[model samples]
Target: MEPARLGSHLVVHLNRLKENFEALKKRYKENNILFMVKADGYGHGIIEIVKYAFNDLGVREFGVATLGEAITLRRHLSSLPFEIYVFSDLQFFQPELSELYLEYRLIPVISHNDDLDVVLNNPKFSNLPLCLKFNTGMNRLGLSLEKSEEIIKSLKAVNRCKIFHLMSHLANASMPMSTNKRNIGQKEKFKELKEQFISAGIELERTSLANSGALEQESCKEETHIRPGLMLFGATSMAPQHVDKSWWQGKIISELKTKVLNVFDVSKGDPLGYGSTPCPQAGTVAIIALGYGDGISTRFMGATLYHKGVAGKVCARVCMDMTYVLFPKGTDIKRGENFWIWDGDSKMFMELARETKTLPYELVIQLTTRVPRIYQID
Candidate 1:
């Protein structure tokens, strides 16, 4: 059955995604790419992105935030021999989860000593590949450096959960100059912990310290694997100072387009949208079928969008399912005309993000399932 059609939709360009992956692969020639598909491929649709990456691009490893996501991917790609690493903590005590982990062959990243204990106690996880995350500086997840030796000793004693990878997250790989010291310190700390594990006679197969930002830093390239999330999807969270923008080959993979639902002429001092924010002067307002409900944030109240070749300023508060944009007087806008909110243009989205005082990740990932994803593979 056809789903209820919404005028608003996100167009994901598969070719662009492939290009971004190739660019990163070429740039980080030494490291294996663990393409991050968490957050629904950063809101690009996970299953689709994973299929393209695995079937077309030959990406053998994937990184997800949850075990559920890994299970879903495993089911979808049952025929493919790919490894999925769940970055989130695994509920090791749950027998059901242990069964699922064994049945699907999902790798869990042991973050803390408690999690390690769970894995060690469960003989079902024996001989299964595992990843150990150290909290070098992120402090979000992973074991602390102070407890690294203790954890390693415990793991060596149990001899369960084969250590496939040793990894850490960089707190500031984007701003190379500003966070240079912190980045170096975190790397050193991770290295120290990794060496400690090695010296304890625990053989670690691979190490991944570089994320998308760290992958670009010359100093942060010493790793066996790199997990690139935003950059693989044709966007970057890195600051400009750290990268030569001109040399960036990644293209925006998602294009958000909607049609003008209504066109109305307003008088001077008239108000629009939820708050009735007064229109500065008499002008034409084009109401598009897109709003906060569709992941367009309220912060985009005064954002600008282009239709045809003319630009229009978003006026007033954005409604749940509609947004009002004001254009100049006598503007020729039709109800069915395409309103380009974000059209696979990185600069435009960056400008919008700046105007809204939000990050690109927030804007993209918050796009609810209400907006259908249309793929442009060619």
Candidate 2:
């Protein structure tokens, strides 16, 4: 933020990221946390977020979506002690990718028989550490719970890696689990599978099912580990407790800011850009450099951008490379003044999302690489 950074840019605050992470750790002290680094660390730059999480936060495990992401992280972070799990990927089951999985020390989640078969048939991967994902109630990529006995029996014979995590996805984690039958059933079934494993004389090393939203609810209790994606980056799907909410009080990790490109006067009768939309009121008109092409769509036309302690409405249609803002009449402004856009704070972010009929997840991920990211580590 020093020297008034010009143009539209995302300021990545590593310090806030640390605070957000520590807050999760403080409350969930008993359960291990696997930082979800998929989708390029939820569009915050994978390498940057991973390195910080590993070195500064002492995070030992990460979860990615593809074989490429797992191998790529292993290459860049050769010295770090970490575990990368491929949740769902066609590449994960390919015979060609089997060696890369062993070489990179990546753990593959066996969602079905083929995923487990690929590992069981190959001597190289037969002994590799793996996670078993069960369908429970998600109906996504997971084996049926009844296959728990057969799957564990197959793995118990050849696996030497100490990792044995029974994993599943909660279809209704965004809602309260105590009130949702599907979520409760998923948790109960997963627990039954764990007991089934113990009955077979193999104590599973861990069990995981919690995501960002699940951590705030009662479902987080039984799990030995939690997978946090969005919350670690400064936004949560659920309302957080006061202790955790305090960290997101005044600031955010990813600060979206843009400089005012132009300032003009628009009378009530004057026509505006594109479509010649007549001005709604006589106000101070300011143009910014961010637009639809930058991932901010037309849905944000009415959202507000804060500048110099005042909020200006995005009055005109968002163009490919520019947007028009309308401030109150006689508002003081300049072409180079910085305007605060989205800050990745759940409160403000969700507010904008409500106005735009978008999700906070959608907005953050939509920001293209065109909006350069400036790292702040202090």
Candidate 3:
């Protein structure tokens, strides 16, 4: 392996990503993979994944969360013919966003009636492709089924705005057997909305609503296109206990390792980090470069680290840019030695989530964008 990069260098396993894409294609052969490249491909480096999927893996469409994200991706793949769509609500960025949609040939997911006007009224965008987003029940984004119908009628009157796709989001497809009525209601409403759109003469080039949750459910795969996020990174879908099996199936996509900046010997009674947390027995302590500022949450305080196949527990509260771990007496550790924080053999992220009482998605996204992403073929 190469020298460990400081801060966070998410090591994406391109091989595993390819395999996951294949599995999804096999499972939903009729649907297209709108591989979610949002949040910089969920902090795994969007540019690398986009290129791999389009050039080698046969994926033709990508989804982003913001207009800026879409713009950044377009810069990277200037000549790729793949279609790019922004999955976020269209209301936030009006004329400017609408203009970008027209210029880049990008599709904006419209969730509100006013959103349609932004595109239709903009002289520069009156003739671009648009994706109508129906809210079925997620309620986070997308227009209600009734409002969506009206928007369709309005769009039909104009010979401009080309309709590319009709889309919706799933609220609880991850819990395939959930007895939650909300999930049931959302599914029914989304299905009905799709049928209504077709009956209203609002023909979409493609109809899609399956997200990661929907892809996990047999019923959700009926859609013609599905957008998958965490699943592509091999994270467990809503169920933490099911993680071990997922790990084996997908290679560790993000490997966060930091270099040891210093090493010191401390007495058993010596006070450690903020608030004077006690040092672990009398032993040598090694400090690693990474902390909350770099996106390593404070919950990582008591998390474990792997050095040369041996496990060591963090001995103090994590600082804004560093953390210390106690090594057993006379253990071999050096200033430049690498420490694995969250990688193939370590469950630091899972452990940290347990300490903070949170989920993997929160932990994953909390990792800031400042951290450098290093991509490699394995």
- Best candidate per TM-score, number? 1
Q: What is residue 277's positional error in candidate 2, in angstroms?
A: 3.3
Backbone collision tally, model 3:
0
Alpha-carbon lDDT, every model? 0.81, 0.78, 0.72
Compared with the true structure, what per-residue lDDT tens digits does model 3 show for residues 256-304?
7678899999998799889899886898898888888878777777666
Those runs of model 2 whose alpha carbons end farther than 4 Å from true positions after fitting are 1-5, 156-163, 239-251
lDDT for position 358 in model 2 = 79
Model 2, range 1-378, lDDT digits (tens) per residue? 454355688888999889888887777888999889898887778888899888889999999998888888889889888889888884754578778877888888878788778877777765677677889888889988777777767766775334478788888777666666887788888888778877777767988998877775535666889998887887656533322422332235788888789999889868888887777889999998888888889998888776775788888888998889899987888988777787655577767867888766677778888887777887
CA displacement after TM-score superposition, residue 373 of candidate 3 (Å): 2.0
Who is ahead in TM-score, 2 or 3? 2
Clashing pairs in 3: none
Which window of ten consecutive residues has the lowest lDDT sum in model 3?
Answer: 242-251
CA lDDT, candidate 2, residue 262? 92
Sort by lDDT, best first: what order? 1, 2, 3
TM values, all candidates = 0.93, 0.90, 0.86
Best by lDDT: 1
Question: What's the count of clashing pairs in each model shown?
Answer: 0, 0, 0
Overlapping backbone residue pairs in candidate 1 total 0
